[model samples]
Target: MHQPLDIKDKSSDKNSIKVEAFRKHVRTTKPHKHNNYFELIFLSQGHGTHAIDQEKIDIQPPMVFGIGKEQIHYWDMDAEPEGYVMIFRSDFIMNSHDKALLELANELFSHSHILLSKDESITQFFSLLAKELKELTVSPYVVEGLLKALFGKILQMALHIKPTQDKSKNLYQQLVDLLIENKEYDRKVENYAELLNTTPQNLNAICRKIENLTASEVIAAHIVKEAKRLLAHSNSSISEIAFHLNFKDSSHFVKYFKRHAQVTPGAFRSSSLIEKRN
Candidate 1:
């Protein structure tokens, strides 16, 4: 069994945000999943493969990758990686109650990665962010404000660079959006199909075309992702997690987890705890 590494930011003040150059840190290059924070990585120079949720993406310079919390991922860099890594808790942006900001953040998280070319404005923003991170006396609000501006700019660039939209792709993106939004209460393909005003077969076909996975698999994957996050990061018991995820019974939840994860829920939790301790 491959245990996913749980990486934590151990800043002295327990700050909700962290920004640093990627090559400065020396750590093992292993498969891992972040616990509760989202990651935005800017790669200015690198050649490698980035695996996210079973999808392998080729590395290209001047690209940005956005990863939501608990998404399994790893890096295999053929050469030294160089760029800035910005990590911040999801609640840090959600709690702001700025609807536009929240929507932009959500949009960025919707994609596995975004391709970019060197732009002077983006470069200047990153430089400003790096400077702000060095000034320990800067207020938290100031830092957060800067982050919001950076995200806004990224969102704008993404909008312009997004590939031509088609009906099939749009529907597929909607399915993904709904999966993230309603992972707890609704886990049925038919339910999502009806919500999209399409039949289950049609929905499945769209999903297959977009991601090579059926609609049911997509829903199950999101549910399992959330379940793992709760097991690893929360103090919730197995029964509690089952209930929270709308599982009818703990036994059924265990079976489902085992079927996909190749380990029972209890065993997974125990291993996760042991990993944390080490």
Candidate 2:
């Protein structure tokens, strides 16, 4: 069994040194986090809901799934799906000159970039990608070249993506950066709008235009995302978790969690812990 991606610090020295791949079951998924490794899945088998970030999609055969370290995701298994999951340390491509591509690769897998495309060319590219992964297991030089190609493919797809527009996106991204950096979940939109030198309405309009997300949507995203993190890791009480998240009350936090996640906070926490122990 494997720990949830959240509990293990993928950025730790332990995850920094190796590239590994194998088949794994859903039981190993406990809402864990990945901090160091960039992961890709050639889910040749399996059928179920694959929850990544806020996107929940069904897993069909031959899907190319990407997960990054910061994304808290889970597989609620159904139909006994089995697949190949490959994890490689980020340092494996640390010295590459193609900063944009490498960063896109990391971001795509790390969950920062959660959008996926239904483009036809992606299928052909992934065919080559799967073949390269096979070669990497037997040849280091081949693996290195594959890594570079993988990075390039990531950028190519990203460039072709239709931007997710939101109305107050400038404020949203800024506030998201602010909250992520400061570790505050309850910050107001006005706070961000004020800092951006715009009215809340103006900021909200931009985020909605850019991402189809409202100012509140952006805020709730940050809060719920972090709540998922705490639920997966620390064995803190619901009340304590509320306090840590700066919620006005435990009930408010619980309601917020359920609204965004479709589960009570306690349920999510307990489910993650049980999955890890199983």
Candidate 3:
């Protein structure tokens, strides 16, 4: 029997947040998904590729990668990597009840990769954060403050690297969050709009404004993305996948996948297998 992608736990049971030197833990990893945490990696030095879902990024110094909980990623480092890795869960933010901070994190986590310019402030921030995390008497308030500042610095640099629209009171982010949270493959724009407390037209307007796609398109895109993940990472057959995704039948799923991805599910799976082999 074919095995599924590995699911790894990189959490700190003692605290909601954990920070460590990346070099100490740096190694090539098989494709895996983390268990319910946000991972932020800052590399001062590294060489190789980091594949997050479908996108493979070149490892360049002074860069950061924010891996979300649902993303599948792997490292193929050709050299020793020097960096810091910070792991935190949503519980850390939710416990604070800081809506602004939660929104900031949501925006930052939306991007999987960010190339950074040389910034002494970022290095200093990470160093200070690591030091604080090591203290026997760790201060939650101080850690929270440091995290905010560090995230701000990284986001500031991210703006210059890739300009994103202001997501203040971001309905699009909310919609995406709901989509990711959902498990039953309910990809209806009307259902999501209702849950978001807005009309489908308004949701579409917001989605189009932020993502240049209709709400329906955004939902379809998410469905396709999940489909691709299941195809590549799971050992389920097309019929099983269709059932799991709540499609009426396997034939319907095949047509839908083809309409969006321009290839049949079987073809996609075959290509994924071939890619894995070589």
Query: Which stretch of 10 consecutive residues in model 3 shows the poorest summed lDDT?
Result: 160-169
TM-score of 2: 0.54
Which candidate do you rate higher for lDDT, 2 or 3? 3
Which regions of candidate 2 fall more than 4 Å away from where they truly are? 1-6, 10-18, 24-28, 35-38, 47-49, 53-56, 76-99, 106-148, 151-182, 186-206, 228-236, 248-278
Give all candidates' CA lDDT scores.
0.73, 0.60, 0.82
- The parts of candidate 1 lying over 4 Å away from their true place are 1-13, 24-28, 159-221, 224-278
Candidates sorted by TM-score, best first: 3, 1, 2
Candidate 2 C-alpha lDDT tens digits along 96-213: 5654444445444433332333335544444554576545355545555565565455445553353322333334444544565555565588877787788989878876775688
lDDT of 1 by residue, 60-129 (tens): 8677899876576778777777788888876677677565566566666767888774545666677788
Give Cα distance to truth, residue 263, candidate 1, Å: 17
The TM-score obtained by model 3 is 0.90
Mark the 10 consecutive residues where model 2 has the least summed lDDT: 162-171
Q: Tens digits of per-residue lDDT for model 3 on 105-130? A: 76677778777767578889989999
